[model samples]
Target: MAATDRAEYCGIGIRGVAIGIDSFVWFALLFVAITVTGVVTGQVETGAQGVHTSLSGTPGSIALGLWVVLTLGYHALCEWRFGKTIGKALVNIRVASTDGSAPSLGAALIRNVARLVDWLPSLYLVGIAGMVLSDRRQRLGDRLAGTTVVSD
Candidate 1:
């Protein structure tokens, strides 16, 4: 492909690293949020208490769900406003359609929702693997949506 095409495409290799970095940052943020919530709530339990706590539907699950929503919202808003997430902005990368245009709202939402498949199980290993192996560095979502992440 031409340099311009490459610039407008993620090409598996580069996008893999970017996705890895993004996942690490997101997980770190989630961890911090959970820790802070625990501290604030004074609900830190020990041994069997911890097991029981989880069995009883821990507040952490609610917080985690909220975090997921907020994170997706941030990504959607940032991509709409600036074509990148903070991490993507820092790395000079942007998410766009294959035609070198910003993705539409429907496309963005579809891509992110498909992230469930990309993030299967945990740690985003599936997404990372797919990105590394795919021609366009796309996870399942990007493939399905005809979108791409590119260097801006």
Candidate 2:
């Protein structure tokens, strides 16, 4: 809402669409990786309920660890390097510092890490609350990183 700014802050609705796209991609990637690892490591099971994996032992731990790394790294690296992930790019939005510069690597990392906290209590309620309360429509991650998703 600055006089000189052409880029407007995005709200939760469009942001939600971008996240849906990103989450679908993330889910697909995780499904493949976990399924392959589980089968290869003999950690998968076919039950009356459904086909699933026991992510409970060392193999499970490693798979979970990989998920953590991939999820965080994917968002942070993309935001740092290009200001947008594929979903955000498709939505024509980008993350930028409050001062209108590209976000730094540290900022991007903090933003993605804060996503864990924002995801708490299910369905990104915390993030939505933060965005609603913020004057610039920032989620917790954006506020923490001094970044905002903006129209491109």
lDDT of each: 0.70, 0.88
- Measured by lDDT, the strongest candidate is 2
- Tens-digit lDDT string for candidate 1 (1-152): 43337585566556556566677767866766565556656665668545222212567776687568756766666676677876787777888887777888777877887787787878777777778887777878887777778878
lDDT of 2: 0.88
Residue 106, candidate 2: how far off, in angstroms? 0.7
- Runs of candidate 2 with Cα error greater than 4 angstroms are 1-4, 35-55
After superposition, the stretches of candidate 1 with alpha carbons farther than 4 Å from their true spots are 1-8, 11-13, 16-58
After superposition on all C-alphas, the RMSD of every candidate to the true structure, in Å, is 5.6, 3.8
Candidates' TM-scores? 0.67, 0.83
Model 2, residue pairs in steric clash? none
lDDT of 2 by residue, 33-144 (tens): 6887798899898989999886667887777777777888889999999999988999998999998899999999999999999988999999999999988889999999
